[model samples]
Target: MNTGDLHLLTGAYVLHALPPEEHADFERHLPGCPSCSEEVRELAATTGKLASAVAVVPPPVLKQRVMARVAAERQAPPVVPRQSRRGGTRRGRALSRFALAASVAAAATFGSVALWQYQEAQDARDAARRTERRAADLASVLAAPDAKAVSGGFAKGATGTVVVSRTLDKAAFLASGLPNPPEGKVYQLWFADGGSMRSAGLMDVSGATGAAVMEGPLDGASGIGVTVEPAGGSAQPTSDPLALLTLPA
Candidate 1:
């Protein structure tokens, strides 16, 4: 996906309407692009609200009243529309994607917009706080004075890189083009030390890529490794590391 179209994807991404790869690409794009991230935050304000809100059953007579009213209303005359080619332009396609996403979001809350908006404001504030803390930590890792990067090829086409910073005693991992593990499995990160692999954390491959600031301190860790493990991870890797990158002392 091109950068131009990405600017138009915040709505669809929040709506979960984008395809898997496109979704991952947009996620990789988020941290670097403040405008796009802010747009996602704004568009996602109502996300959890929809799922958590209790469903209110309408009165049994409501449907009948609406049907009766509809039956009495006059039907509009049908007019054939002219055929037009609007798909050839780039901007038009992007706009169409955004419009469709916006329409879906709008339709879900059509009758309760006022009440929903009031509720969404609170959720939005909470989401914003969490996003800010994550952004701050990520910024620190990227800006670390002694940061160094080690790249790993987990698969033929996949690239994984671990950036460790001695100055901040922190490490961060980023990978793209990684295939998801088999059913009931997930990719877990490890700190290889003294011939032992201690779990760092699990890699989230829900998108086209995965990234995280490695858990635990960077002390005495010889290297970082990736492995396919059971869903919740394991005390020790049951298989060989797909990529074992020795960290610089």
Candidate 2:
């Protein structure tokens, strides 16, 4: 099978749904592809946990009752009379078509669910990588010898701190005890010189606490300011800043 087809079978392989022939092919490919290997491992572990969580024991008499029913079913007479050769051929063809359609439908449903789950797993991995990068940037700024800290509150209850590396032109901001913005509004950051301002980044103030790291040429900036703006932020400050911190000369 091609790579695309083989990737789609990762979910099936984990669930033991693939045929023996395809299973062998996928096994050969699994060793060389880290993405597929990792996905299969995660899916297999999740499936095992789910299986172990729901353990149901049949009643002692359940097997005996099932065998009795099967014996009675085997003894029942056929509902339809034996057909002529041509009629038997037509009936067989119809049964084959019905079975094929049902199999296709079931396969489609399974493939869609597997694809969705894989996409969600990929999204989670991307978010985790972004968070790791952010943490690393914060650590670097904190460790810099020239780093400076500025703290203030935009409103009565909202307070935040900005840590800047004077030699590196990087900053990390952390805020806490902030109220949610008004409808259709968001918090935006700006690097301000004496006469003009440039946007540093935008922030979501929905939570009581939020943090972000900023990297740019900040040598010319005289101060950092925060303001309420429309979602996605603005090119310039459209309203008065809620808080401002002047950088030391």
Candidate 3:
């Protein structure tokens, strides 16, 4: 499956919510993509921790309240059926037509309201997901045994430092004390063998200490550099590096 398909179902797969068909599809793709597998494990572990922390306490009167409401609703007068009456008169036909129209209107209104509520709930879930992702990222960085702070020179008087780590599956870069770029520019990190370069991460230099971090697979990087580039960054550096550091392995 394509990267888009894998990402689309990653969250569901992490929670084990996919149907059998989709589960098989995700399994087929996982072995070929280490990044997807790592993200899935991170998400699943976070979700499992959350689940374990939650207490299960059904409301004491929940069943009774529900059954009482259901009974009351059942006792309510039945909606008049809209079928044509046998040997019906004009008035009877008019009543049936009115009832039919009312029923349709009610159903439409309820459906619209339900749709709106579902959309609102979905928006809430999206926001919660973003917060969870940010938290997970910070947690992962904090938990890494190899993560550490390092420093280097920048333009003339400017200087910067970054937290760096090389994990078995991925690399993480975090920098601070760097100046922000021009309005249309951004800060980008590069992986270099001292002579050649590869884009490591696209970054922002606006935090209090101008902190930004990127996590990606880099099994072959030898050194690292930071440069100022266009917002989305380029495949290669187009300007002199503002900071540079060498990776251990």
Candidate 4:
């Protein structure tokens, strides 16, 4: 019915997650949109590889949760960027959290402090690898050669910024001094193209400041718009925007 964000359905189509009606819509959509078609091909190929790589398939619920998280958020945890207007270091908090997770996982597995200490070297290496990978993913756009950052203001001292890199096909949405989203709503980003927009996933914002790596690529998107959407992001923005920041060509 609503083919507005048919591009966002690639993942669902690949996983057979779309409802019958929406599946029909997407099938109709897949013919003409090269980007969505290409994405579906790549994703389907990857899905095949992953399916064959594992000896056993995951439970349906686990698969659903994984797909939901990827489709909904696809965001890095909130971290103050190096150029944060509020003026703070970036990366440290995220890295610390990763290390903390590693230590917790180690403790849970070993169940004894001495046992954890015995495996300290191996665990530390695992933690280092995890943190490195996460930080790299989060900073991909920020560190890109063509990265550009823009800032704008919001009501009640709140402010927003967007950093984009067409080269990296990524963008980061950052904000400060905003209230938590209304109970069932979340901050959603859009790739503004003229009057139309496409979903760019959701953010996990919780306090005075937040930052997230937006979902989807930057091509064809003229700017970024933020809005409050129902929990697992929307196919299109449903509310007035909290901020709109244009990107350079």
Per-prediction TM-score: 0.49, 0.62, 0.45, 0.47
Question: Could you give candidate 4's per-residue lDDT for residues 1-249 as a string of tens digits?
Answer: 444345446656776768998999989878877756765675566555444433333465754664454445332222223354132223333332333333333333333444446468668999999668756767887888888888999877899988888778888888899889888888888889778998887776766777778878877888888899999888887789888888866
Per-residue CA lDDT of model 1 for 28-143, tens digit only, reads: 98888776676566446544443344344346675466446434543221111223223324453445344434643554455356556766886899999977886687679878
CA deviation > 4 Å runs, candidate 1? 1-128
Model 3 ranges with Cα > 4 A deviation = 1-128, 156-159
TM for candidate 2 is 0.62
Candidate 3 residues 1-249, lDDT tens each? 544345345556654568998899889988876655665665455444433422332365744663454334322111222352232334433333343333333434454566667778889999999768865775676467887656566665566654555563444555545566788998887777557987767765555245444546555766678888887889888998877776654
Error in Å for residue 85 of model 2: 2.5
Ranking by TM-score: 2, 1, 4, 3
Best by lDDT: 1
lDDT score at residue 93, model 2, on the 0-100 scale: 38
Q: After superposition, how far is residue 163 of candidate 1 from its true place, in Å?
A: 0.7
Per-residue lDDT for 219 in model 3?
57
The CA lDDT at 229 in model 4 is 91
lDDT of 1: 0.71
Backbone clash total for model 4 is 0
Best by TM-score: 2
Q: Write the per-residue lDDT of candidate 2 for residues 1-249, one digit (tens) a residue.
A: 755456556556765778999999999988987756765675565445433422243366744663454335322111223443355445433443333233334444454566667678889999999889988888988789999888987688788888888787887777898777788988888888778988988876545887777646686888888888998889999999988887654
Shift in Å, residue 39, candidate 1: 52
